[model samples]
Target: MATYVNPGSAQAGAHGTIYREVSPEQLAVEQQLVDNVVASFDACQDPRLQELMTSLVKHLHAFIREVRLTEEEWGTAIDFLTRAGHITDEVRQEFILLSDTLGASMQTINVNNQAYQGATEATVFGPFFVEDSPAIELGDDLAFGAPGEPCWVEGTVTDTDGTPLAGALIEVWEADEDGLYDVQYEAGKRAGRAHLFSAPDGGYRFWGLTPTPYPIPDDGPVGKMLDAVGR
Candidate 1:
C-alpha cells in the first residue's frame, strides 16, 4: 500500500499520495486506454471534428479518473440526465436551462461573439419561440388582452456603420407577470411573444409587457434540479 509522508516534516521534492498510490504500470494502462479510444476516431475524415472529439475524450477520461468517480455516483448522474431528457417536449427545454445555468451557453456565446461583433448582445434563446407566430405591424401592442403592465418599446436596426437596415425582422418575447410563457397557458391564450418588421427608416416600435425579473420555469426536472442545488 502507498502512504503519504508526514506533511510537517516532508523533505524537498516530496510527492503527493496520488503519485505514491498509482504505480507506473497502472498509469500506463490508463493512458493506453485514452490513446486507444482517441485512435479509434482516426477514421473520421473531418480534421476539425476529429480534433474536437479527441480532446473531449482525453479530458473526459482525465476528469473521471481524477475524481475517482464511483459507479453509484455515475448511475445517479445518468438518472438525472435521463430525467432531463424525459421532461423536454415541444414547449419545454430543460436541457437548455441546464446549459444556461451551467454557464455553457454564455461561454459558447463568448466564443462565437466574433461572428456577431457588430450585432447587439442577445439573451440565450429559450424554447418559448414558436413557429408561425402571427406577425404584427409596427407599433402594435403585443400585450393586447395579455397579463401585466402595458409597455411600449422602440428600436432601430442598424449596420456596423450606423446606417439603418430597413425591413429587418424584429422578434420579441418575454415571460408574463407570473413567469409563464404563452404556450404554458391553456389553448387560445397568448402573452409575451410576437414579431414585427422594421420600418422604412429601420425604426420599429411595439407595446408589450413591462420587463420584470423572473425565475426560470421550475415545474420541470431541470427546475427541480436547480432548486435542489440552491441555484
Candidate 2:
C-alpha cells in the first residue's frame, strides 16, 4: 500500500519518502507548459521563432506520448540534461552535437534554408565555427602555425543570374590535419584556420591543411546515448 503526504512533507530513511504520486494538478502543470508555448506563439512577431517554437512543442509532446515514459526515466533524463549543461563551455557545445547526431540540426537548416534549385546546397554548420577569426588576404594560408597537408579551397559567391556576388562574406572554418578544430586543442593555437573575403568578381580562395574526419566528442550523456545506440 502507498501512503500520501502533504505537498511539502519530508520523508526519512535510506529509501527516503516516496512522496505522493503525480497528482492530476501536477500533470496539468506539465500540459499547461506545452499549451502556453503554443499560445505564446500567436503573440510572437518573428515568423521564424513562431514556426520553430510551435513545431518544437508539437514534437516534444509527441515524443513523451510515443515513449509512454516513466517517472524514473524522466528523472534520469533530467539528470542527463543537467550534466550536459555542466559540460558545455565557450569552445564545446555538447547539446549541439547531440542535436547534430540526432539529425535535428540538419532538419532545422533544411527546413529554414530551402535550396534555390541550382545554388550550392546548404549543409549543417557543425559546432566548430569561430566568429571574428583574424581576417587574411586573398590567397593567404590559414594553416597559421600548425602542420598538415596543404590544400587550396577556392570558390565563387554568385547571384542567381550566374554573375559573381563580389565582396560577399566568405567565412571558412574546418578541422586541422588531425581532424580536430582549434577549439578542440587546449594549447591555445589557431591551426588549420582562416577567414577570407570574396573578390570583386565573387572569387574567393584560401589555403589550409587538409581536414580529416574525426569522431565526435564522447565524454557526456550524449556520448553514452550514442554508445548505447551502437552509433
Candidate 3:
C-alpha cells in the first residue's frame, strides 16, 4: 500500500513519513496513467492548447485520486452537467450560473483583469448582456418605457491619463424596481438596457431605472444544487 501524502500537511516535505511509507509500485501505476493521458496531447498542433490540456488532465486526475471519488459520485456529477447543458439557451445559461455561484467566474475575471492606474476594475460581464442592443444618443432614455421610477444616468469615458475618449461605446443594463431584467419577462420585452457613444468631449448621459436587489434565477438545476447545499 502506498502512503498518500496529504498536500499542505506538516509531512509535506523531504523529512516526512511519505519518504518512508511510499510504495513505488503503486505510485508508478498512478503516475503512468497521468503520463499516458498527457502523452495523448503530444500531436496537438497548438503548444498552448497542449500545455493546458496536459495540465488539466494532471490536476483532474490528482483531484480524483486525492478525494477517492466513487463511481456513484462521478455519475452524479455527469448528470448534473447534463442537466446544466439541457437548460442552457439564448436567454438562460445554467452553466454561467454554476460558474458564478461557485465564484469561478470572479476568479477568472481577477486573473484576466490587472489593475492599471486610473482604469476601471473589471467586473463580471454577466450572462444577460445581449448583442446588437438598441443604440441611443446621449441623454436618451434607456428605460424604453419599462416600468419603474425614472433615473438619470451619466458618465464620462477617459483614458488612464484622464484624456477624453471620443466616441467610446458605453453599454449599460439593469433590472427595474420589480427586480428583474428584461430577459426574465415572459413577453420577451426589452427595457432598462441600451448602448451609446461618448461625445467628442468624452461625456455621455442617459435615463435608466434605479438599481434594485434581485435574486439569481433559481428554478434551474444549479439552483437546485445550491438549495441542496443550503446556500
* TM-score list, all predictions: 0.83, 0.74, 0.86
Off by over 4 Å in 3: 1-3, 6-27
Candidate lDDT values, in order? 0.76, 0.77, 0.83
Worst 10 residues of 1 by lDDT: 11-20
How high is the lDDT of residue 128 in model 1? Answer: 67
- TM for candidate 3 is 0.86
Off by over 4 Å in 2: 1-58
Residues 1-231, model 3: lDDT tens digits: 223653353243333333323355866787899889999999999999999999899888876665556899999999999999998888778888899889999899999999888798898877677777889989999998788988888878999999999999898888888888898885357888889999999999998997889888888888899999999
In model 2, what are the clashing residue pairs, if there are any? none
Model 1: lDDT of residue 222:
76
Q: How many residue pairs clash in each candidate at the backbone level? A: 0, 0, 0
- Model 2 TM-score (2 dp): 0.74
Winning candidate number (TM-score): 3
Pairs in clash, predicted candidate 1: none
| TM-score: the better of candidates 2 and 3 | 3
Model 2: lDDT of residue 153: 84
In angstroms, how far off is 217's CA in candidate 2?
1.4
